[model samples]
Target chain A: MSLPTHTPVWRIKNSPEDSVVLDSSDEATFALTEEPVPSLEDGEMLVENVFISNDPAQRGWIQKGVLPERLYTAPVREGDIMATHSIARVLALKDSTDQRFKVNDFVYCMTAGWRRYAVIKTDPSACLPVMVPQNVSPTAALGLFGVPGFTAYYGLHDVLKFKEGQSLIVSAAAGAVGNVVVQYAKKVLKAKKVIAIVGSEEKCQWIKGLGADVALNYKSPTFAQDLVNATSDFVDAYFDSVSGVILDQVIPRIKQYGRIAACGAISGYNKDVGKPTMGATWIEVVTNRLTIQGFVILDFMFPKDGSNRVATEAFPSIAGALERGEITLDGTEDIVEVPFVDVPKVWGRLFTGANTGKLVTKLA
Target chain B: MSLPTHTPVWRIKNSPEDSVVLDSSDEATFALTEEPVPSLEDGEMLVENVFISNDPAQRGWIQKGVLPERLYTAPVREGDIMATHSIARVLALKDSTDQRFKVNDFVYCMTAGWRRYAVIKTDPSACLPVMVPQNVSPTAALGLFGVPGFTAYYGLHDVLKFKEGQSLIVSAAAGAVGNVVVQYAKKVLKAKKVIAIVGSEEKCQWIKGLGADVALNYKSPTFAQDLVNATSDFVDAYFDSVSGVILDQVIPRIKQYGRIAACGAISGYNKDVGKPTMGATWIEVVTNRLTIQGFVILDFMFPKDGSNRVATEAFPSIAGALERGEITLDGTEDIVEVPFVDVPKVWGRLFTGANTGKLVTKLA
Candidate 1:
């Protein structure tokens, strides 16, 4: 089958000094030019993106200085397109024997990320379930019902094994994964206290609205002390999204027999040679008998048991709670779904801690 | 029974700096001093020193700073004697019904460390034990068969969980714990390869005598490379007595899922507060999946399922092997078995690394 002529791709120019800039406004050197889509091969299907995911991890992938192999989702070389998540429709099928995909059907693909038009060489359902859930938005398939949600679930429920009546502290608690983590810890884990440590006061309140018992501003001068005092018992489980001074401080305060699931170190990605001064403070981990496990979500819910198994195992208990209004999403009260074209600008603003609610970029 | 008022006791002065002094001549500080002996109370037994154990850990206990609390086995209050291993004869008993003690029998008291006279309050039976073989001096019980020996055993056989045919690396391999650690790893644990990292070329030869596969002097400029080259499989277990530059290097080279029984950090003890920058390089712990557990011999072994259980469980097996002369401590063949009076001098020499072999101060 012939594919569309134009494919939208995002490119990173020079290494970003601190934050990733996606729009054409900044001095970022590279560009994701609209290129002519190649013809599909046998056993291949062409997918048109209906929703895309923007992750802080992308900051690591696009930056030239970051180790090339860290781009695990898809190998991104110089002049190649940046990678991210997107749910797309199978606009064309190259092989009749390809029983996995229909031409008009929708499928979810993670490796085939960011690009508007992709000539997927193999069946997408082989990686993640391709069957579209009725009533759930394609963007929801990329957000709450996707990798971010699974990461929050597995890290909290499995790795941490957080028990009831314990405090959970999350760093970068306003980001996509962080928001889901806060809600999961509070509602599903039945934590006595769920505290969100974010970069701004507004982000703190926004996370607090997402069923967090308290949201402490990590940017405040007294943030560390405030967190220490707020969670005086000290955290039973720490979900670290940002790894820097916050990690260094939080580690020393974790209670005996505490667990920490370190998913990302967003704080160090931009630093030239991010000498993260933070350490396990071995004395503390020993004295407290703490266990910290570093994990990538891809290691867990991928290849075989992807999101559906997690959603199936997870959603039953949470879905009823959600339907009963026991669990909630922050700023779900005032939803703001922006168009796909606004992604770069919205992503730029997201890092500034300006967005208050779930920021989903819609493509129809 | 009234305690003898003339029993000499040496008290560490109130001034932190005055408690420990490094001598320019001979380089040995007294392991124990002759001052007024400790007074006895109810339910306490006055134990006359039969043997005293000197460990590299004593250096840390007298260390001026770095959390002075870390320096003491028990708090060395203004007038209290420093505590350590003492195989003592019970001179006077406050209670005849105290089954933990018998008037003339010998018992090892941990709290009465490095002293000639100790009045231990607990049931003396509850303290650590050693049955002195008629041919082997009670002092040998302190060095070869007691705390140091137990430290080596627990560290290798328990903490690092040494498996037969695995590589083992022990720092300070000529010192008391290191000397015994290397022997046990090679002869008892049946380690395939045991690489001992020591201070001097002479000490390397000494460790070689202990049945080490190879002994490497860490002082060499090529120490890290030499260590890596020597241990082809990388270290399966790292028995760290010295946690300084060597450990900074070792932490990186540790094999995947390696175990570090961090018994002591003797390397950084001398430096004043924050003076010694211990480059931990803990990221290696995460990436390589290493487990570094710090332990005081007392803390590491005494509690339930701690080193005591390890000591009782492992000692007999190794002792049977040692009895057959399968394990021996004679690499350097330099032995400093001095009178109690020479302790201060020998201990001072210990810090300067002048005296070799286990310096066991003999007490009659």
Candidate 2:
């Protein structure tokens, strides 16, 4: 089989001070001589990637590691591949013994890259059988049909244990995952009220279009008071995707026996700053009978077995809901395709806030 | 029926400053004069005094309504009679409707006291039946066999679910409730280690005698470090009867899934002088997977069929162990017997820190 002489990559150079600043192109980036095409050994396959995902959590992954105890995601050495999730087609296979994939078959894989092609070994931890929906483009798997969707689904339906008639307060409610949570809490769980806390006034209205019962602009100085008045003395569950000063205000008002699912800390992701200063309040968890748990979807979501079998069974209903327009993606549902060479520029634009939804690079 | 010319009562003449000072002997205290003797109605009996209990928590009750939101206990109003647990004799019963009691019976009744006689109404919430053991003194019901013992028994055995070969750490281990917890955690629960945090070196050694594996004086500068060294990374449960600077140190070091049964917050009970501070730090809780619950005995120990069930079940084993000498109360059990006239002076001495385990007044 013939191989491409040059591959592409995007590197996050010096980090920025804020989200808006970091997402923009900086003078410090570098794109040097691309490495030669590598061979696939046993248990490895060479794949031409079709689509790559850019998520808000990717900002967190760049700044933090999988676990808090880890120093960073990259290897201790300086020149290491960063982590990413991509949908790829198998170009060549080394192991005839492996039955999960065949040459030219498309598979969703989580490996390092904005690269056009890479040699990936069969990861024992990751398995792929669910194909890209025939009705939707392959890039749709990167956003609503992929990690962000699963994270939103499991967080609301499982971790928060969303009950009917309960009120759910979700920060970042206009973003990719937040939009899904708002719809899931409303349509699937029949939540009595869904209070969307968004960064902007327009985004607040945008989330309301996605079936949110109420939307509030967190940018307002009266945000905390607005939340208190909106929930009407009852906030049963809090889905916290952006934890910062907003979380500090949200915690005290949660009703008795309330649950706060700490999904992600995106508010501080772009800032490679020191740990956030803590609020000096004792939460009196018992008096309120509160349960707060931190979880990552990958960490908690098991394979289609055990307790997660229920999640697998419910996956279709969630997907069906999305497909039938019961749950809607508000912005840029179409894949924004660019040549494989523009991956870094797209990534720079991603952090700059110029792009909306998933950014995928097409390979020829 | 003849009534006494004067009756004794402990009065907080005014809310005390930083320090707690009681005046049971001040003649200027609301005088009990020219009032007709209270008559016993049906379901009620007249209890002549035997012993009255002095507890540090009494100060907390006096500062705020015992139940912050609801008046569960009979109100302890200013200029009203002070309420306390007393082992008393049923001198007379005007009506014999309540099957639980009869005239001339030695009954343990919690009454408004520091007096010779009290007309106790048979309010189930206001009083509890004390079964005096032949081997144990009537005064034991005033403390070691009363609420303090029950608190320790339920909090450790039931709430903390104390396991053998696990360590149990308790604050204020020499205090009435804490001393019982030390005995129960060590002898009854058969915990591998019991660490007691006490105020002084004297109390530390005293707690150590009551089967505490290690006792650290909380007042010591290196107390937190000493506690850390003593446990050596194995702290399964923390029975926090005292919440103070001690809790601030113990919390960060607790093992994962550790249960903190926060029974009371005695350290900050009297805030008469200083401003109220932050309640509890939330980050330590999130990082540790800690379950901190503030509860009163009433929340769990609902008696089945009018028998104090926790007492009937847990008490037997505890009492049997006490009888067999498997558990011993530290010889510092200070039993102060005062005449009917001296009740006022003894009440004044309680907050001065002169008394220790089970301060009971005997009337013979």
Candidate 3:
């Protein structure tokens, strides 16, 4: 395949103050500019980007200050290429020493920044080959067979150890990661009941269609009482994506020895530093003997053992499920795709709860 | 053994409104009264109480209203005997089909109320035999080889799975459970460092004497910075007996994959019902990938399975350690004993941080 001499890439213009949703009057928070493609160096492979994932974590990456040092990747700063996971096709390879990926092969770039083309290292340590089964759509690789899918799988199966016949509750059940969590809990784990907590009636209906036994709109005036009534028997596990007052309400209803997977705290993503995020009261935790654990998907992908379970276990399982038509993308009606140039505006949809399914930008 | 015709017992005079520490103008929250000894029924055993344990949980048990249903034992009601654990001698037995205990044998009663004599069920389900080593003092059975020691052992070794060479932070390090936690973490677990967060200078020195590498007076104005300075490498595990703002400070300094055993929240014990207790922000939990679990010792003692690990593991291990003089009670200087009549007054010492070690009332 022939490649263009120049490719357009989005660079963060300035750090966001609170929320990543940029205002129209504010100078471009992310600026699109064309640059000459650099020649590939030894051990590097050039890729033609197909799809760039728009995740809720993008809000945290663009925050004004640097995040405190931790095990995960560092926050993106001004003048940096807006960081994202991208599905791309390898156009050319410079080094023959490493044979993990070859030219014209489709690959999943874990750290592919927002650009039309990404120059990634050919070493298996840097990227992995993504094989989309013949019977499945390519978009399945971006959704149910991707990082979001693996997060829901590992979080419930590995972290929470969700068992068959146990009841589960998921907050933000209509979002990308949460959608998969609800499905996997109901379909794969055979959970007795799957309750979905969402923001709007539309999201409630959407998640309900995806096998949620009960859907409660958190915006309803009687939501708290509704939650209590719905979970009269109490839930055995809670997959939390939205923390804050939602946690405060759900935690009291968690059964004794219930496990909580704290996957994301999107509610506090935009809050100022040093300010306490609203959370479940610790008194409930102690009295109920609850176990709450926070996790990041990256840990499973690049564990210390050098074994990538996602490639060996999750990907094959999810891909086979998609190929068999057990998991469908039909319910994800609000996955609005925008041109690469309009990435900044579409990115804001994540925080506004306007976009459904997996939000991704199309790049050719 | 002969039983008294009349037994003196402490019962709740009225539920505490704020603090269990009764004010001068207030009626006695716990009142000492004399009652006729009840005759033993079939399958019941009469016990002469020796040592009744005083725990911080006493404050919560005396609260005015009914607690919301959860895993923990409910509060003792007005006109009811205050509940506590005690070491007592079996004075007499009736219809003792199960041969777990005989007359004059010592046993640990999980439900021996605050009384001079208690009528207990002889069923193995009710109480278990307590074997005190010849070389170990009887007090060792009430302290290091008892509930406090078992809580520390199970929480660190089982719940937190604390490994050697890892750092630990313990709140209320001078109290009964906290004392054992610090000693076990330092001496048995061989932790790299043990940081003790206490309330007073006396407690600072006391816990330091118990082998705490660092003791920070939480009341110190510069305690937060002192914590940062002391734990330069960040803590790997925390045994939290006192939860409140202290959690807010320590949580931010926890290393990635840090574990927290939420044993107690003494700071909020006397707070008004329905008021929120301050706790570690959940954002840090997510960002740090931390695991926080709440536990009570009774769960381990009376687990659904008939196996009681506390009896088979903790008691024997702790008793052996005490017999070998590996664990000492020398620094526990504040175990001030008073007459049973002064129980209500001395009970206030717990909340006031005026007493240390195991605060037990002498009933014989």
Top model number, TM-score:
3
The order by descending lDDT is 3, 2, 1
Candidate 1 similarity to native, TM-score? 0.76
Candidate 2 docking category?
Answer: incorrect
Instruction: For each candidate, report its DockQ versus the true two-chain complex.
Output: 0.16, 0.12, 0.34
For candidate 1 chain A, the 10 contiguous residues with the lowest summed lDDT are A272-281
In the predicted model 3, the residue pairs found to clash are none
Worst 10 residues of 3 chain A by lDDT: A272-281
Q: What is the lDDT of residue A187 in candidate 3?
A: 79
**Most accurate candidate by DockQ:** 3
lDDT tens digits by residue: candidate 3, A1-364 = 4676788888888787765546544565787789877888998888987777778777766767645474266788899988887778889889658877787787888666888877778766457777566755555566777778888889998889999999999997888888888887887778899999988998888888888999999889999899999999999999998777788788878998889999887776666422342332556687789999999887886788989798898878766665565566676534456677776777777777777778776752
> What would the DockQ be for model 3?
0.34
What is the per-residue lDDT of model 1 for residues B1-364, given as tens digits with 9 covering 90 to 100? 6666555444444314323453423332332345665566677777777656566565545433334322324334444555556667778877556675577877777776556666677664435445544466556566667667777876776668889988888887877778888877887778888888887888777678778888888778888789768865677888877665667677656676677876665554443311232232443343344566555555544575534564466557556766888776443223456665555565555555665666755554
The fraction of correct interface contacts reproduced by each prediction comes to 0.03, 0.09, 0.51
Which candidate do you rate higher for lDDT, 1 or 3? 3
What is candidate 1's lDDT per residue for A130-185, written digit by digit as tens?
43244555565555666677778778887788787888888877777788888878
lDDT digits (tens) for residues B63-116 of candidate 3: 677454763886789999988777788888888786888888888886768877
How high is the CA lDDT of each candidate model? 0.64, 0.64, 0.78
lDDT of 2 by residue, A56-148 (tens): 555544442223432123321213354467788888888658798888887777773666778877764433644445666666667677766
Give the TM-score of chain A in candidate 3: 0.90
